[model samples]
Target: MSRSIEYGNLMHDAMRGLIRKVLQDVADHGLPGAHHFFITFDTGHPDAELADWLSDRYPDEMTVVVQHWYDNLEVTDDGFSITLNFGDAPEPLYIPYDAIKTFVDPSVEFGLRFETQDSDAEDDEAEDPAAPAHLPAVKPKGKKLKPDETKSTSDKEDEAGVKDAEIVSLDSFRK
Candidate 1:
């Protein structure tokens, strides 16, 4: 037989269950002495439930420390939720299993690192529902800059790598 079955998906799913189980135990019983978790996840992931301000601050990825003060730690099959201190107040965070890239318990020297997954988020989906995504103010679309407003210096050209680029005309390829 030449056909081969891929077990990588199965292994990944099984491993995720292990993380769920460990978190469930932590929810049931208070964290044992010196035992805590350091979870790292993609902050920009669409399913990640966190403050938009936080996601903006940590655009790509973020690591959260769940130690002595976390409350309402709940783990479901799809994701987990917990209240953590942010600034001077408590904020809830929800992280889907798929978003997690690293889990560690330094107290026990246990660590698991997962390969990063391709982001599924589209432009609109990146907006957090609970809080609007923090973004720089932008002018409305379709506005044309006046010739005087256009950049005259080559500074931007060098930064954009356009200075070394050869101009290509699509008309040449057509004929």
Candidate 2:
């Protein structure tokens, strides 16, 4: 007997759920100890809307930092809302999970990326359709930077020593 491949929309839903949880946690506990988020989203996504000016400004992609000076955060079944200070003006934004492209927390080096999907197809299949129109795209795994690309603190110290030796040579010339 052979088993059929189980490809469904469960993963997509699960990812949405996780994004919801992360937002919920932040809203509840107020970003808990040095954890800020960089959220990138598609501005044209159905569930995403910005002020007319903002939409015009960032027609494609926008990234927002949720760290300090945010207010009026509310989470709902459909989406979440928050007020951000944009250049001395407070703007309210409501973002749906489907619109999110990426969420990164550099403090813990944890990040999540959501696959883009057709909004209409997703809604239709979500309404009791058998299979999702498209499978969730596999997330690309990131490899650590090579040693040559990444310099450790010791390498900085060595460079500092070389600079100090140059300074000593200059002092001897002055003497």
Candidate 3:
């Protein structure tokens, strides 16, 4: 056992693809029936793109509901964009896959918790178990983040000079 094959990273990449497919499908069509999503991301994470007000409102983490009142939902190769209502106003949002921390469709109880860590972590590794589980994304209009999906959250963080992202490992419970 090498204890360093990075299997977790592989799993994270696959999960990101799955999230992309779902978001793309929804962007093209629409939410099927009762299938809404609970997206949680690190608002403080450097890679996120959301509005200033939103960031102020949710500093560390925030979750938004994607059900009936959203518009301009576009999913692209690297990320996605959409406008959501806030206090009777529609605001734009953009989120890269790397920023996502958690994704869940409670209608099916299907959810994913990603790995999050500080700037010192190496090779896009797992999150610190002691840190908060999930949070919100930045700047406004597009695909925002949620749990780990081993999606990378760099470039944006690089621009911001801060560190943030997510993924969850059950390793802590076994020992």
Instruction: Give the candidate number with the greatest lDDT.
Output: 3
- Expressed as tens digits, the lDDT of each residue in 1-175 for candidate 1 is 7976544445567667888999999999988898887677878778888876566545676667787689989999998999886544577999998787666676765666564334574354343222311221222223432332211111123343432111211122221
lDDT over C-alpha atoms for residue 36 of model 1:
81
lDDT of 3 by residue, 94-142 (tens): 8777677777776665767677434475654455432333432232322
Provide the TM-score for each candidate, comma-separated.
Answer: 0.63, 0.62, 0.65
Among these predictions, the greatest TM-score belongs to 3
For model 2, the run of ten residues with the poorest summed lDDT: 163-172
Listed per model in order, the count of residue pairs whose N, CA or C atoms clash below 3 Å is: 0, 0, 47
Cα deviation at 157, candidate 1, in Å, is 35
lDDT of 1: 0.61
Off by over 4 Å in 2: 1-8, 117-175
Query: 1-175, model 2: which lDDT tens digit per residue?
Result: 9985534356666766877888888888888888887676778888886787666656666667777778888887777888986656678998887787666665665666665456466564343322222212222223222322211111112332421001111112121
Would you list the C-alpha lDDT of every candidate in the order shown? 0.61, 0.59, 0.64
Give the C-alpha lDDT of model 3: 0.64
